[model samples]
Every structure is written in structure tokens, then in C-alpha cells.
Target: MHRSAETSLEDQAVDIRIQMIQLGWDTLTSVPKSRAGERSVTLDEATTRVLQEWRTRQNKERLAAGPDWNESGLVFTHPDGTGLRPSWVSEEFARIAARAGLPPIRLHDLRHGAASLSLAAGVDVKVVSAELGHSTTAFTQDTYQSVFPRVAREAAEATAGLLSGDAARQA
Candidate 1:
């Protein structure tokens, strides 16, 4: 069985290419003008599963709607096939988080969380920056430095250990 780098399932390879921005209730746009925001992101297994489930539900909804289904080709949308407003997404996130007993946070905080968690999980900052559509690794480092102090210390210690071990071998 062939497994993709992002997903272990042979048939579950997902390629992300676009982000959706809704300008109004009826207006949706793709292809961010900024090149940084146009990059693709690899999803983890849980995320892929969630997306797969959502896709299946969406397909069923589309079948039910029949001719009424709007062919938007968006990753996320309202049940009736309309694009979701940014405000609606933020409000829904807060509602769900609150229901789950999570502390209050803006939807954008999830982006920061993703970056910091990835870095702490040993993903290179360069790769994280690219996935986040940041123009440069330094910008990512500077922005997330405060969020990953422990990670920074651990990295420093690891580097020191490597150097000390090398010196011991030479002696």
C-alpha cells in the first residue's frame, strides 16, 4: 500500500491549494493576492479525518439539495452551500470552545497555537513558517519566541549536549 508523506492511508492523500475569503454574504473569493498566503499546508491524521467526515456530510447535503446546491468548491461553507463569513466563523469557534470549556480566545489565536505547538513538537521553524504562509523563518521565530521559551531552552540544552559529547569523544 502506498502511503503519502502527510497521511499514512493510501487513499487519503489530501492536497490543499486555496483559502476562502468571504467579502459579503454572497461574495466569496479564492487565491489570496499575497504569495505568502497561497502556500499549501499538510494536515495531521486527526485533521484529515475530520475533513474527510465533513466532505462526506457535504456531499450528502449537496445530493439532497440537488439543483439548489451552489457549486462553490470551497473547503468550508454553510449547509445550503453559501460561503461562511469571517465573523460567523469566529463566533462559531468561540461558541464551540466555550461549550468544550476552553478558555476564551480569538480564532486567530489558533494560528499562533499551531505554530508554537509545531515548533515545540520538533518541527523546524522554517517549515512551520512556510506552512503558516510567513514570508521568512526569522519572522516566525520572532513572533513565536515568547510562546516557546521552554522549547528554546530544550533546544539549547540539546545542542550543548551534542557539543559536549563530541569533545568527550575527542579527548
Candidate 2:
């Protein structure tokens, strides 16, 4: 519930929306390191539900604050019910990342990380690309190629039984 005083109203509102939706709002709103994320990775269904619930809660707050609850269209609204700005959202993303001891990567790195993590988990590249909002499969593959080695290594480890597993078990 504690917020920085310097925090802009715009960001505060956005934070509220994110909180309400329970989505990885910070991840979805920020641009991605890869071009694909800038294009896609919108709030998933579960997060969408959180947003809907927050929206209802916000509506009640609006009604309590004023009679113009009907005009409150956006999920995140100011005390007077205005839309949140983009810069504020970005600033907060940076602040949170810094606090978390994360590397000083762009806010969008989450998209790439998500892709890398998914690929590592054996999710298909096509799915990763789509989730990352990649325009072409090749681009997705190119950007995430670094993951292939790890992917291969993980696969080998997971199926160690082919050779290593057999030898180890016999011993």
C-alpha cells in the first residue's frame, strides 16, 4: 500500500489497474527487448479476471468519491477519474526492477526473459514467438537462438537414461 511520494498520479492509477487485474501488469505494459513484445503479450485471462474484479472495486470507490461513476470508463483512473500516462508506468517499472536486484535491463526484457524461460521449459518456439508478439518465426528464432544450447543441454540432462543414465544405473 506504500507508494513513493514522487510517484505520479498517472502511475498510481496504472498500479491500481494492475493490482486489480492481478495480471503481470508491469510485464505486459512495458515494451519488450525483442520487437515481438512491443507488438503483443497482452494481459492473459487470469490477469484479465483480476482487472475485472479491481474494476468493480474501483467503481465502488468512484461512486463513493463522487456521483460521476458512470464516466469512469478506464479501469485505472485518477481521484477525479482521468487516464494514467505512459511515462509514469515506465518509471515505476524501472524503480521496481532496480529494487529487486535485477540487472539494469530495459523494462521490456521481461518479454525476452519470458520467451527464454518458456523455451527452456520446452514450450514450442512458435508458441514463444506468438506470446512474444514476433512478426516472423525466423525473427523469434533468431532472437532466442542463444536459448537453443541450453535447451539442448537441458533435454540431454532430462533424458539422461539414453546413455549416461543407463551407465550410471548399471554401476
Candidate 3:
């Protein structure tokens, strides 16, 4: 549920960079920049390890930048004192996607991806809405119906899953 990198770091320029810290990627709460804004974005164990390493590096950077820190208290930073701008980062995204030969996509797709992935994992739509900071569960259901239709259709498919016999015929 990443926002523009700026939104992720809550800054103006993204200098602190993905390189700056070991982002303690554990947990699913770090849905940074979810509709609610910068917050936990629970990550997996592997991500946690990477973030831990990045954390070490961030401290190193802090020491290196002593006296010149912005002190925004954010996990991500701008290298120089201050934060990043969401717009610049979002534009770079499109250029990068085009260069990679992938379909051009808005950065918001990551938000969509989060909802989709959660649904595929059988998580409840309400949970996803809260995670994304949506105002209501219906918004989550409407937004990710592609991933959530199964829940809606579960009853209809119950008999269909039955193998052969009268059940299959009824389905």
C-alpha cells in the first residue's frame, strides 16, 4: 500500500532512499501511506531481515549526517535535511515502467495489489478496508471485487465443488 515514495517517507525529495535503512519489514501494519497516511506496513520475515539490515545502515547515515538531520522521525528520509515530494517520485515510476517494457501503471496500483493479495489469501474485505484506511468495508469490496467475488459466491459454489452424483447435477 505504498504511496509515492515521498508519501512513503513523508518528505519532499527521496534522497534517504531505499538504500538508507533496513526497513523492519515484519508485520502487516506498515501499510505506509494507506488512505489513512503513513503508518505500519506489515511485511514478511524476509522483509523484516532486510529492514533490520537497512536499520543498521540508517543509523550509520544518521551518524554521518550528525547536526544536519531533519528529525522528521520518519523511517525513510531525503538524505539532506527534509522529506520527499510525492509527485516527483510518482512520475519516475511511470518512466521506469515504460523503460522496463511493463504496462504503464499508476503507483496506486500497489494499493490495489495489497487489497487483491489480501483477498486471495482469504482475508476478510473489512480487514482490508481498515488496513487501507478506507472509509467503509463496502468500498473495499467494490474496489477489489475481482479478488473478493469468491467470498460472495461461496454458497453458490458449494454444491458445484461436489464431485459427480446428484449434487453435481443440481449444481
Off by over 4 Å in 1: 1-30, 147-171
Clashing pairs in 2: 20-50, 21-50, 21-51, 36-133
Clashes of each: 0, 4, 24
Report the lDDT tens digits of candidate 1 across residue range 105-168: 9999988888888887878998999888888899998887454678788878877887896866
- TM-score per prediction, in order, is 0.75, 0.56, 0.61
Candidates 1 and 2 compared: the better one by TM-score is: 1
TM-score of candidate 2 to 2 decimals: 0.56
Tens-digit lDDT track for model 2 on 6-49?
Answer: 12332222221121111443313322345543432345566666
Off by over 4 Å in 3: 1-41, 147-159, 166-171
- What TM-score would candidate 3 get against the native? 0.61
| Least well predicted 10-residue stretch by lDDT in candidate 3 | 13-22
For each of the candidates, the C-alpha root-mean-square deviation to the true structure, in angstroms, is 5.5, 10.4, 9.9
For TM-score, candidate 2 versus 3, the one ahead is 3
User: Residues 37-134, candidate 3, lDDT per residue (tens digit)?
Assistant: 33344455666566557556766777888999776555545675354444555788889999999897998897888788887787877777766667
Q: Which segments of candidate 2 are over 4 A away from where they belong?
A: 1-49, 67-72, 145-152, 158-171
Identify the candidate with maximal lDDT: 1
